[model samples]
Target chain A: MKLKVFLAVFACKLTIKLLRLLGRGGTAIPGKIALRICPDLLFQLAKDVKCVVVTGTNGKTTSSRIIEEIYVKAEASYFANRSGANLINGITSIFIENSTLTGKPKKENAVIECDEAASKEVCRLINPAVVLVTNVFRDQLDRYGEVSGTLENILIGIKNSPRAVVCLNSDCSLTASIAEQIPNRVIFYGVDVPIYKNPVSEVSDAPHCIKCKHEYEYSYRTFGHLGGFCCPDCGYKRPEPQVSVTDILSTELSFTKVRVQVFGEDDVITINLPGGYNIYNAVGALAVSEAVGFRRMLAKDAIASFTCGFGRMEEFDLGGHSARIILVKNPAGANQVLNYLAGLSAETVFVCCLNDNSADGKDVSWVWDANFEKLADMSELIPEIYVSGIRSGDMAVRLKYAGIDEDKLRIFDDYDELIDAMKNQSLPVIIMPTYTAMMDLRAKMSTAFGGKEFWE
Target chain B: MKLSICHLYPDVLNLYGDTGNIICLKKRLEWRGIDTEVTLLPIGANADLSRFDLFFIGGGQDFEQEVLLTDLHGGKDKEILAAVEDEKVFLCICGGYQMMGQYYLTHTGQQCDYIGALKLHTVGSDVRMIGNYMFKCAEESSGSTIVGFENHSGRTYLGEGVSPLGTVLHGFGNNGEDHTEGARFKNVFGAYCHGPMLPKNPEFADLILQTALSRRYPGTVLPPLGDGLEINAHDHMADRMEKQ
Candidate 1:
């Protein structure tokens, strides 16, 4: 190794140790320092390690965790960035921390969740063995500019990794279109059957055909713009998936049982995560595992027992009241959370924390697109609605306009007061926070309740 | 009194929660005991534009805008221009705002013809002007400060015949260099604000509603509903932007 590489590794390792000692779990700064020392350190370290990269607007962290679970189940030596640090810097930090002093990777395998915008640079450096795109949706419009712009970024990322086998969500019209352009070997995975009996009309991100301007016709819609989409004019239809969820047996608040078919065989798997979106995640995870040559049974076992990382339906005990935190960043993801909320049988205190922080998409207008109007139907189950975060006033206005009773809308800008307000509640509390709000609120919740720090 | 709302190109140009503006208008009208009917007029949908009192057109991606341009050329542009001439209440935002202009010049210098309903034209820029912004409405528009989040690469310029909808108080509006935020010709309103530009700004929503209502029922005055929550939301955003 060069002197610069050795120095970069040493400096990065020291920073990680110091951060841990100081009880500050920051992944970006350490890697940033190391990169400044040795610009090619990540490429040098990641060259030998087999990596599976997950990138998309949503389900990236969950899909990464599910792949991590497969690695754990198979007893494969691997390291993953599990603390919601998916950027190039944060991912570089993970690689540096997992490497030996001489800059050799400690593990032969790795799972990385990459941000949509940062995926191109990260993929170019890592040159992953398997690249899984969960799905694309209109996310953080101010940051991405447009959903098509986001898709272009991911496409560029895929183009950079020619050797990597691309695993895609065929149900997503935007995601599936990548197969038409890229030269990489592709494996498609999606839900074959409709996830909902009565699907609500959603404002689709890709209503017009990706290839042609004609509107798409769906045989069945799973959620949002995902489904058996076919452009009548262009003949651009959903490609047949090699790995698919044949049926959704049952769905509950905590878990969902699905009959998934992989490699011409069907297995009734219990996805520890709930919602129709998780089913897609499970299938995408399976596709990645299969592409990476993991045994089907081991991947199935991992799927059945997989637990989500922080803030992706992360549950906690708030002084005896059950509190579940669902991180929502975009309309499609938020709609799924709202769908989950509408399905709850018992009365609950619904909390929506919105922030205009950069990571949370400074434009909070997406709250309106999330179909919060669905809460009107669940007024009986959702008795109290708590709106908190920097943009709590905006969220409160959105909820009120969504037909939520003004009497139930409560604004709590302070997280401590918000948590205190929910402490005595006997009803289950569902907290839907945007990305930045989730990080801050999760820290506060963990500090009060005493849970594992995110880094650990 | 009942009013008909024509939501133009909902499937194509419905980005950044622009649908919220329609929802706000519908609910606000219902709250005041006014019956309202909203009709979605997507591309290829042949509907008589004369029947609708108010029309809404939202922003879309560049690709969608190209597709919309092709579809609009098939008589919809003429219908929209005629509607604007008749002083129909039209609310166009971002991409929709650009489409109401004489033409849109892309960053690459590709000019696309629009409806020519307003004496304005948009020029695409490499840098997207994005952030929370506050603008003071023109004197004719109640002069209230309207707060919204704008995300657009198009720099729109008002021509001699057109008047500005508002003056920029904070952040970039229309073009980054100009103080003008939007274009207004008769009852047609076009702006870059798409915090959907309605739910938080009750006055603007009411302005559109009142414009549509008065056109149908001559000399009718709209009764004021409770606007405390709406005003608070609007003020909170305006204050936040001002501080920034």
Candidate 2:
């Protein structure tokens, strides 16, 4: 077993070095090779490191970044899979890269963002100290089958890590239901108050009660089926959150200030990122921090100081004009970004890059599910609308049906052309791209304009 | 002219932008100066099916479909069947399409009965048929080519005497085995395509609208809206499908 572990580590390290030399970014390939050599290599490398695994549909990367800040502020020795490589192979590669050739971890702690479907086996092997599920939304239906299947996958992960403290979003009924099934130490986090003045109502992924088949009744919905929910028939309700945003003091383009109640004590927290969705992520980060033995003030300060995640409201100065790339995959996330765009009073140019790549959930039908109608509703604020990517036509059609004037719509199949169009414009540009589209466009923008590569 | 559209079980079955069909139907009618009302009948809602001229049921996950089976068995199926027999225009997609069939046999050999509004039955498989696909409407229909995305694991087969809504031109339709895509019986239409099935295919959207409207005003002709964007989107998919 020891020989196998050592051989796996050596092979993985060699592959990583070779890939770097070849100028190829293969985050999951080396780990795949190592795992083939020794299937138990992850269990060996992750044995000594304390880990906090963040997994869910929407806020995994953002929440993990916030937790990384908490780790940094505390001056703890840690490593992270910060390159959006959340699958088992990618996570294994991260572990092996952070460890010695003998399959022993050099880092004392780790912050890992894991994909929901991959979390089941990854969490079992890593045996994290704290497992945080930000929230579960209907995402990548072709990949996970459905929202319930995603929930089941996460549930199995939480179930496997029985010793790990499970932190859940109380507002998400699908996520919150995991608490009922697991025997682990569970913590809940949510936003107590409605975050938006005018919330867009899309179809709820978890409309019926998990316990009973009855529809859920919301007292006040924050956005996209999340809020104070209670099932009338079986009495399944949103649990009282231990860490929650009690009130929103103010919301700005860059940040949001909110009064948060942790346990019984209340404190005002300035979430460095904007949008109501990030508020939930901030509170979720705090809850995970609490579970991981970080001080409340440390977590609060970390959230205040943490920058945005890659392609998540990530800013770039292109030819002296400001452009922000907001990654949108599913309806719930897209609606939140749309809500944030709606809040902007300044004239803006909206760029939507939609791809049907495997990473982007090939079914582009989700464009219709998201409330792009919000853009049409507030067309006075948005001067120009540009659509790009493999499915640009589908996106253009969706916007047309959403009531946006066809004259304002432009389709750019090339990223360079899309960037040029945005750069030529005077107004601030907000680019919303699907996963693969963002990666491709961000790479082009990084090369032409100036920004760090996503992995770096 | 006015038409009421009952979006049946939208709470449970609104997966894959399925409500886009509702948006397309509503917008097409409203664009023609026809007053349109959309009513959402969630699970356990007491819906008088006869009041609505058109009905739509989207798809859902197997878990949601399972949860919905109880509600359907609790007498809602009777209402839906009655409405289908009344020749009310109905559009069902994916799981909703499967539900309109007689029954669905699961991979585990468990048989689940549905409303049986059409002469069809489906069998679930582990291998899911998912991708962009194109099909041509049956001869009796517009015979226009329709493009949409299909993602389903249930292989549905229409019973004898029942006609298919369309023939698969490219990609897997009802099942990968058969060239048939969706079932058409009376005024009901069922398909597995949910690139929400309507917005991009303006002709199909208009056809459903015209059929529903003609119930109130016979020989109702829909004025053709400028479908340049929709046609471009549709052609993109059709072109891609042809290339593949």
Candidate 3:
């Protein structure tokens, strides 16, 4: 039976490889075929490679990418699904991609970034040594329910893997408020920047509290709701962080000097990724690396060299016009984009597109919470704006309430019309779009203007 | 007449663009020459509740709802409630709607009592009521589909004989118990219809303004429908029929 299963798995890979060569949806093809044939193929195949899994509501993709790169430098020989295939089938496809003809994986470690709700199935298949939880927010409410309920799902995976968990401490109150009910190795990482403004990473969850049934009092807001916070009521405060973001400065467009807290001293870690938000993600990667036995020095060296991964904080030049594409999936991310744009004096029009895709969170209502209206000064900075998406009118209303002059806003539901307006208009465009909408816009632009390499 | 619209903790519950309701109301009222000013009441600070002709609250997490509840519970909000009962218009949604009620029971089984404005009780923490919710005013000829998402665990229950905000056309609006989601108290408007409640349905927003206006200016009649009102009303009625 085992021999038959292994052969079937191997044959399925051939189909996936052929499909991949054809430039179709190749990643999940082989895995789905094999899994359909032999349900237990995942457990059998991952026997040799040590697996390290990362799952959370946000930052899993970026955190896993950084960890994968760290292993790449370690030259331990690893296989990773780099294209953000986070679901059960997605991880299976990754396992198939790196498997041998004899159904053997060719890596020392197979680090996977699994989807938050799908972590249970993956853990059941291959028990991992380390799991990194980034943070939880009220994201994709239509599909994922609430943050607390999603936390329950994450708790399942955490219990499944009891050996190690490098949990983000900045949100310890939220993720760790429930830790007493569960048992695991919980390590935390975050930045401790106060009395200054972060030029790059501006999006964070700042108002959540511990136990007082009130908003957490923050000494400072890092981005979204990640910060040092104490409940104003019963004095439930932020957990003392194990690792703190000591010092960070956005040195240039795609580079920054960030000092991270190690054993007892502040060590300077340089990174070549733009935006302060990426630095926070880098903070998560480093903390998880230290917990998983990767030396801080080696991890820093590997990370600082990273130019861009996935599609965040990535810059592309379509033509005479250059566009910086950042996935503005939530208010926290949108705030960071505004923060980055606020610093730039160049005449730039923000092209914000909103779609109620499941991946982008079906609730477009969260835009009101984003603080765009308060950044009305940005409207004056970049006068011409193109609001286009499934919920373009919604975005326009938000911008208007944020004190943005209503006259400055031009609404477009059609991507083609919006992109044409963008291309024809002389000013630089900051393309802040959500989920599949970003991909849709990217496809239209790339098809019209050669390919993605032009943006790079 | 300078009508002050107090945007309750506009910094906090503003998370879901719930404040867009304020923007919609303000713009429509202003367009009709009604002097409307939306003010953000800072936490613990006193703004003369008597001065405002209307009140607006958005949505937030249970904790945030508690924070605003605490601040408002201790303050002169009793007078604000009086202001509404004494004939001021009010509109609240989601967390805002939740906070205006008598009490909210969190999923963890803890109860946070809110400002005594609406006779509604909310039980939070547990399975959140999510997905796209459609709202059809029970007796009204027109309807609106709130095309956003919901992520709250607290199930709400209206007091006996109290009217619910609207009937659910799409999702589980007020938990599994009541398909009749949200609450409506006199001139006080509250609901879980947090699709910014207004931008998607401009006519509905105009109704809110018009209601507030008849209170402020008892004699003036509403102007003719313009822009997308007719088309939106048609689409909305079609939606209800499709649901039926």
Best by TM-score: 1
lDDT of candidate 3 over A129-162, digit per residue (tens):
7777777766665666556667778777777776
> How does each model score on TM-score?
0.99, 0.97, 0.83
Docking class of 2: medium
Model 1: how far is A415 from its true place, Å? 0.7
lDDT tens per residue, model 2, A316-375: 997667999999989999999899998999999999999999999989899888998889
The deviation in Å at residue A22 for candidate 2 is: 3.2
User: Could you tell me how far off, in angstroms, the CA of residue A195 lies in candidate 3 after the best superposition?
Assistant: 8.9
iRMSD, all candidates? 1.0, 1.1, 4.5
Give candidate 2 regions above 4 Å deviation.
none
Q: Which ten residues in a row have the lowest lDDT in candidate 1 chain A?
A: A196-205
Clashes of 1: 0
Q: Give the TM-score of candidate 3.
A: 0.83
Which model is ahead, 2 or 3, in terms of DockQ?
Answer: 2
lDDT: the better of candidates 2 and 3: 2
Once superposed on the true structure, which residue ranges of model 3 sit more than 4 Å away at CA?
A: A1-8, A11-15, A26-40, A165-167, A176-183, A194-208, A232-236, A239-242, A405-407, A410-420, A446-456, B8-15, B27-51, B59-84, B95-185, B220-244
Per-residue lDDT over B1-244 for candidate 2, one digit per residue giving the tens place of the 0 to 100 score = 7899999988878889989999888888878899989998887788788999999999887666766888899999999999988999999999898999999998999999999888899999999898889999996666889999899888999898789999999989998887999989989988998998998888888889888888978987889999988998899889888988
